[model samples]
Target: MKKPIILFVASIFLLFNKVYAQDKFTLEQCVSYALEHNLNIKQAKYTQAISEVNYSQSKLNLAPTVNANISQYNNFGRSVNQVTYAYSNNTTNNLNYGAGANWEIFGGLQRLNQLKQTKFTLMADQTYVEKIKQDVSLNVVNQFLLTMFGEEQVNNLTNQLKVSQEQLAIAKKKADVGTITEADYLQFKAQVANDETNLTSAQNQLEIASLELKQLLNLEPQQTFGIIRPSDAAMVEASKSAYEAVYVYNEALKINPSIKVAEYQSLASERAVSVAKGAFYPSLNLSANVGSYYSWNYYLPVDPANPNGPDYRPTFKDQYNTFLGKSINLSLNIPIFNGLQSRNSVKKAKISYENTKASEVLAKNQLNKTIAQSVADLKAAEKKYASAQISFESLKKAYEFSQKRFDVGLINSLDLNIAKTNYSKAESEALQAKYDMVFKSKVIDYYLGKPLTL
Candidate 1:
């Protein structure tokens, strides 16, 4: 009884797992998963984090530096006392403590400019991370659509195979009743075999597409995966929406992370030039210090009134108060000569600034070109899909008419096969055109900063 119960429990568990594995995923879910698991996005985020730290440190650099020090000294040989400048033969012990602070009052605004440069650098890095995410999302979209197309092909072929098998069954019956020739009946059998082959090929293609999508999502090979297919109406509706190249370019320029990254980098380079130029200017600093010390071997003279009074050393508190000293200083350093390092730095910075400015222009030009091409492709795909749809519908009606004529012995097997072949070709072409149109529309949406769906 116990063994039977355990077996039943195990079977139930396996069934549950199978059901869970077969669950379908929507496009949004796939995109979200890729975003979280993609290695490139993770690396980009790490770089952005480093930029954040640098930005923080640059701001902190403007603050003053404070330090404290302490030391102990023991002298065993004769030495001159620091306090009395007298020779001493006995052992002497001394302790010292001090604290000081230095503040940069001026440095040609170098610190300020450095802060600004880091801020812009951080912004650029942040935008770069977003750019990586956008790249990953687009990749996911492309793969997802490809997998969907494969599924549609498989489904269409499966339906065709069913219809061929049904016709073959009818042909066999007619042949047995001596109403159809053996060649005609055999032709129906051949049609069914060919459709079976096509269906198998489509299924294999679908499996390959699914595997590629799984790799993109970083999923285990053994994992069972399926996609939530969008309805035909949804796809048609999405394709109907149109975008102009100029409008898409204008919108993309405003929100595209790649373009923003270049602009921010340019700003950072400009600030870096200012920071380098600051090295040629004079600098001012302020400092403050306070210190005190004690000696163990030194003592005060004996009291005259009490002639036998023991010689006494000053108390620690008293010594500390008596020996304490404080000082403040202000210094100015004028830049004169240093191997012309500052001049060279400023020159390099200017050149870098120019490079970044050129890069900014290049990025904008590329974006414009891409937007124009995408819009053109989308229009072409729309026209192709429309033409394919009409062709498929016409072929479908012709094939139906020919099949009916063949059923009544009015048409030959060859004529029926020709009509069927034409219809099948049209069907495949229509499916291809439909997916192409959808993908191109999605590309336009991506440039316009719209969310990708279906």
Candidate 2:
């Protein structure tokens, strides 16, 4: 029996160890995982790849092209041949084989312009993906901090409940000794009930927060995760200026992914104008080819008896020859007129370029506005947090004094309960303000291209 008990205990210990061994996701880990698996990041990467391919194709367009061709023809019955003037009634065959190369020495630098535009576009695409990553990281950070706050609030509420229980026990003892009135005991009981209700609400909030975090992680409903809380009394030290020191507005205009993409668009549009202008200039090419040909014919006259020596006896012929040569030819293509197509294309491209320029300007303006607003909100959250911290500190001291007074019978249960309730409210509000500050700060960092890490 002792051996069986030992085995069972060992098995239980091993199972607990296994459960704890599951990997824990830090903020960095979460962000990295999301970057690797997120749908938006994947799509952005694909778009970048397409841009790279387009750019490569533009460069390849300048390279030479080689081609080969073979053709054969047979003619029968009374035909005068080029090499020999004779009426042929049998059959004649001709075969030709050739190889050629065509290369454009120049296209008015259109290929160069296209390649440059594509490169810029690819860079923009890369930045855009980074921007999406920053956004996803921000979301993860917010949800992680929010979940932490909820957990802390729940713990605070639990502590408050414990204090209430202690006070209720003291009240019962005092009432039994005739030191406290029944009304005082009843008040303590009411306080305990209120604390219990608050605890339940906090628990519900924690559950919701957990579910939300799980959703963001794309995890199973039953999965359990943990978040690292910021260091103790962070609210006390988190000042307004320090929290808003992130260079969001300037970076948003300079480094924002959307802004970068807009700039790339403007470059691409400018290249389009160059491409249109290229049509006005001449194009040059160097080309070459090599091949061999063979032909065979057997002929009989149509007028047999009256004409050529008893219908020219059927003749069997065979010939084989091979020749190879190479030549370099420089060709120039000049565009004289195309019904003003090139001119109209240039006009359209110029218009599109202007539109892209305007869009880039708009993007910068919007980015600035977003950053400014986020900064303002962060500053406001800092102020609110400071006030909440002060309120919490005062209420905590008051609660302690009230408890001491009640212990000495200098304060009624009703007054002590009031102090406890006030302290709880202050703590909740402080936690809320602290979390709000964290959320807003993350948004600012995201815009600034400085996403939070572990």
Candidate 3:
């Protein structure tokens, strides 16, 4: 009874393990996980946060500044009473405290320009973060799709293994009954060995695909999971026009995060030029403060109109006073030449502005080039997929014929093997073409601003 119970428990555990091991994973879940945990996306988010702080600083720069200060000084030296306040015999003490606020009235629009430039910079940084997100999503989609295709291949190989095993059994039975030659039975045996090898190879490829998908999702490499095919089959219809996708991509260039960033940078550069030119203009600031001070003194005299025998007296009195005052001061500064520093600044700023414009143009040109290349690739993949369809169909027919002939001894193992190889090659090529077309379609959709969906 103990042995039977132990065996039952072991079987139950094995059943549960199999169920757990075979749990399915979908593409959307994988992508979501990656977005949350991927290192590159996290880094991009940090960069955007830094840009936000910089922008806040730029805004705060325009606000008024207030400061308070207090100081007390004591001096003891040779005293002089009627001349300089400098201590002669002197014990002198002074105390002062004040509060002031300074608000910029004008600075040739320099502060405004600085604010504008930083705002544009912040926009650029944010766009860069979005671009990183889009890139990560694209990568995740590709890997996820590849894993699906790999699963399909593994299934196909398993079916082929089953067919080979069945054929080997038939050949073995015929040999036992002396109806088939030893050489023919040997051929079937060899075919079974090849099929088993192929099955092992397929398993290995499946593991590799699973690992790659897990890596993209930032999951542990040892994890095993199935991927559900999320998207439709590759588009078999050719594009209506070669320029259609290109036009869409061109539109995307207008809004593509990188291009937008470059545009913002150009504006920032223009603002920079204005800031630099501010050196030629003057600035004004207003400041005011209200405060109070107090003082107390005690002295002893040996002979100072003295009554009471060199009188010692505590004549210190508590005196307090408070007053409110206001002042508006105007400062005028005319620009004086300082080694042509202002002129050099303006020149450098103008050069930088020009460079920014050049970069903007370069960015646009690169965008156009990228679009053109992607369109070409899309077309090529479309054509390849069509060719692969034809090749795969023809190879399948040849394989079917070769299989029948080998069973009847009309074809040798070598011929059958060649046919099988051709079929496998054609099938793989067709699958690759299918995936390529899907990937290109995604690129087109991305350029067209289409949202990716399950």
Candidate 4:
């Protein structure tokens, strides 16, 4: 019984460790994983692939179309024989085989223009995929930073709770000895309880933040996850950097996928207009056909002396060879008026092209506006973080002094608790400002087409 109990306990311990073990990832690894596994990115890539196929098919359309057909027919009751070109009273079987090819020599360059349009469309979709990747990477960065911030908050609160518990222990001893009043002792007890509640809340928030990051990564909920934290110095250094909106916008326009997507779409729409206009010009097509047929009822002409004798049907190969025909024809189609369809198509295409051009301009303008706003926000965040740091340091020193005075009976529990509260608020604000600054800096880096790190 004892041995069985020991084995069961050992198994439980191993299971606990397995369940709680964390899978740690750096920022680069998280982004890489999301890119590979994110459903949005996968869907975008699928669209890109479809565009590639369309482009390939458009290129293939420039080639001629070829088709082959074969038919067998049985006729009765004085039907006309196709091979003999005569009426046959007897039941007969006829077989036919043919192959034909048609090549468009010119259709006002419609096919060529369509090919160009699909090529441009394909390029646009490819760029769109890259744009989606950038978007996903930014989202990952946001969630990752939030999770890190939450962890810091939890840590800060936990330390505060420990300090409060220590003070409560001293207060309890002093109260029992009649050195501290009941109200003062109760204040210390309340402070400890308050800290405990705040710490619990912070831990819950950290869990929520981690959960969001895990969802973004498409990880299983049961899977423990952790991030590799960057150094404080690195984050502070990054926050100090400055960016000019004009410079960042210029850099963004050079590599921004969204702008490229719009530009390509505009080019594709322009080609569409050309394709539609091509319908107004005459089209030329060249077609070639080869065919032969044999009929079972077909017979050689009767001999004059043996008219009533047995009739001889021609052999299949002989008839096929003798009846084989080949023809090639060139056809020109002048586009006569047809309910103004061609004209209407051209007009619609032009309208669509104009819309695309407008969209391209809109994309550029939006990018510029966003860059300017991001630069301003980053500057503000830096200032906020700097001020928060100073405030946190001052309150921290004041809190330590209050604690020393309280221990020596120079101050009461309320004074010490107030100082602690102020310090906690400043610490929380500092953490918020620091992470906010870091995130804003990363946004600027994104516009500059730099790899997201830390």
Candidate 5:
């Protein structure tokens, strides 16, 4: 009864989880989900976790290590009693136990350097995790914009199909009344067919965009969810000129996780050199131990002939109280001639530090170039958008005039079709420019550490 009840409850919980996973995601929610689920981000988090563990263990390394040991022995011939260093010649049931601790008091500050280096590396790893998340967020933003654009294209094509179908009906009526040529009616029919085909294509594009968005979100293909576009108009009208490119780039330099990650890595490498140089100096360590042991074949310390004596074999308790031992030692290890491992390590660390410094330089240069290109492209797109808008408004008026003229038999089918085609081209070009400008502006926003949306 309990098993069945538990299974039913578990099934309900699983169903709830599945439903929640398919729930609609806002842009913020989507970004959060990707950070949680994206494989690259997950791996970066794991890497950061490993660095954290190393950093913590390095601190523990500064403290002493203690260990315990125990053993028993049987000997057919002469063998030394490990605990007392006495020779015995019979099978012996014995127990020996001890605990000892060793601590390195000084090692040219190597442990300190290691602790610092691991801490820096851990911070670098953490920053890299943020960098990976930002990358995934940007990708999600790109795909989100594409999906919305594709959906709008679908709506445009649907409207175009409706208008062409209505025009074809009017052309059919005119042809039946002998007011227009059969060929003209045929052109209207062809226009309707073309619009239908375009609508289908737009729908297909929308589906493809949605698929890409789902993939970026790390969602299963079968799961379904809706997206919200709360800032489409604002995005389209965003002006890069409002913010200076160099200022934005400089702001990115201050906050970008990739740069911080590189800087930390370079610092960690510098510490690595210190850790390696530590091996060139002498090390000092302190150690101590206290131990007591007993033999099973030995009796109480009350008899001499019977393996029981006050000064000989004794009970476990008597042995511990009377024969317990303790020792402490201080040792020093001086570096002599070994294979030049220390020198090579120091050399490798310096090289790594140099490489990290170079990577930081490269990252900064690339970011500057990318921002400059995006800014230039944005200005050009702004002009293009202005031109396309003007062209679209003019073409729209021309198409409206042609439609009225065709209805009153003042224009031929070719003239009407030409106006319609030009209008569609102008509208498409204008839309392309708008989205281009939107994307370019959003990039600057991304670099400036702003939220990505719409």
Candidate 6:
């Protein structure tokens, strides 16, 4: 049993290892995969599909209705014969079959208006699908940037660990030669350990970031993947003032999916009002039916000499010819009163239309505000990047000087560590500023109907 359990565990570990195999993808691949597989996007697609079906069905509703029916019955003594429409004390059998059609020739144009309303509602649903895709794309882009940032942070820590390891070796040599104090050598060793700890933490965070990205793509937790980092020159360097931002906002308004959804929904609601008003007018309809029927009575007798059936015992063909019928009708239904149903319906539809119109206004307003805020954030991030650049450069120079002094036993480990720490912090902050600027710019571009890229 123990052997079998061990084997099972080993196999499971191997399977997990296979699942964790590494792969790399570019930004476009990430966004595309998320768009195709994200649960939220898939759900939105389902809604769009349902709307498409409903639109087709609504168009079909404009056609006439047709139905076929057939029935049969048998009666005992004292039953009325269906063929004669008279009562008799004799067994009888009857059969009936027919096809009928009905069409609303006119219903205050409600059918046509309802079709238009369904069409507009379908358009709204289509726009909603596009909006969900855009949202997923934006989310993927943001998460991809964050993962890259975390990966770079881990690289920085790894480099710092290497430098700390080198310092520890130098401090050990100096202590052996009695040039550096034992306490100082021990401190350098401790700094190396701390660097290792920081590297491990940074790596864990990078892994978490990668996992979050995989979740967005609807991948399994054990799946392993990496993002292709764009080179510095390939990164976008978009610049826009408030005026340009406003122009972009106006351009976005022309095609934004969310705004389109609101507009279409409002139109659909207006059509609904028209449909409700139609209920107040008279409706016209046309109907037609054709059928054949038969009946028989076993109690009746047949005459051989006369070469003819007795009364009430007719031939099947003769009975069908006698019972067959065809008719057409035209009807008009003028509405009188219905407990104020039509009035209430029109009122409710009007209110719904007003609400949808307001929602459209809100959508446009929110879009404008978002664009303006994004522009402001981009400018702020630009300034931050410049300041961080200056700070990192100065700290780099100071740290280099500190490293030289510490190598020659002219400075304590504490002083050298302080300089190293400051330099690392500045590097991290600078990188953050750079990415923030890039992300903000991407958001503005996204709103401008530009393809999302690194």
Best-matching candidate per TM-score? 4
Query: Between 2 and 3, whose TM-score is larger?
Result: 3
Q: For residues 300-368, could you state the per-residue lDDT of candidate 2 as single tens digits? A: 565766565544423222222223445778888999998999999999999999999999989887877
Better of 3 and 6 by TM-score: 6
lDDT of 6 by residue, 303-363 (tens): 6565456635667787678778999999999999999999999999999999999999999
Please provide, for model 5 over 1-454, each residue's C-alpha lDDT reduced to its tens digit, 9 standing for 90 to 100. Answer: 8999999999999899788866777778888888788888989999999998999999999999999998766666788765557887866677778999999999999999999999999999999998998899988877777777787777877888889898899888999999999999998888888888878987888888888888877888777767776675566655445666798789999999888998999899999999999999999999999887777655444554755436445657886776688999999999997799999999999999999999989989988888888778878888898899999999999999999998788999988988988897788788777777777777777888988765
3 versus 4: better TM-score goes to: 4
Off by over 4 Å in 4: 1-22, 75-78, 87-92, 299-308, 311-316
Error (Å) of candidate 5 at residue 182 is 3.5
Q: What C-alpha lDDT, on a 0 to 100 scale, does residue 45 get in candidate 5? A: 91
Give the least accurate 10-residue stretch of model 3, judged by summed lDDT: 315-324
* Ten contiguous residues with the weakest lDDT in model 6: 236-245
List ranges where model 3 is wrong by over 4 Å: 1-25, 71-96, 165-212, 222-225, 231-243, 290-329
Model 4 lDDT-worst window of ten: 295-304
Residue-pair clash count for candidate 6: 0
TM-score of each: 0.80, 0.71, 0.78, 0.89, 0.88, 0.88
lDDT of 4: 0.92
lDDT of 5: 0.84
- lDDT by residue for model 1 over 217-294, one digit each (tens)? 787768899999888897778777778899999999999999999999999999999999999999999999999988
- Order of candidates by lDDT, top first? 4, 1, 6, 5, 2, 3
Minimum summed lDDT over a 10-residue window in model 2 is located at: 313-322
lDDT of 4 at 429: 97
Candidate 2: list runs displaced more than 4 Å. 1-21, 69-98, 161-223, 233-256, 291-332, 336-340, 397-421, 442-451
The candidate that wins on lDDT is 4
Q: What is the C-alpha local distance difference test score of candidate 6?
A: 0.86
Tens-digit per-residue lDDT, 150-194, candidate 3: 777778778877877887788789889987778877877887787
Give the lDDT of residue 303 in candidate 1: 90
Tens digit of per-residue lDDT, candidate 4, span 1-454 = 8999999999999898776557588889999999998888989999999999999999999999999989999887888878667786878888998899999999999999999999999999999999999999999999999989998999989888998888889889999999999999999999999999998888988888888778777888778789999898987796678789999999999999999999999999999999999999999999999999888867775585877776788898988898899999999999899999999999999999999999999999999999999999999999999899999999999999998898798999899899999999999999999999999999999999999997
Clashing residue pairs for model 5? 303-308
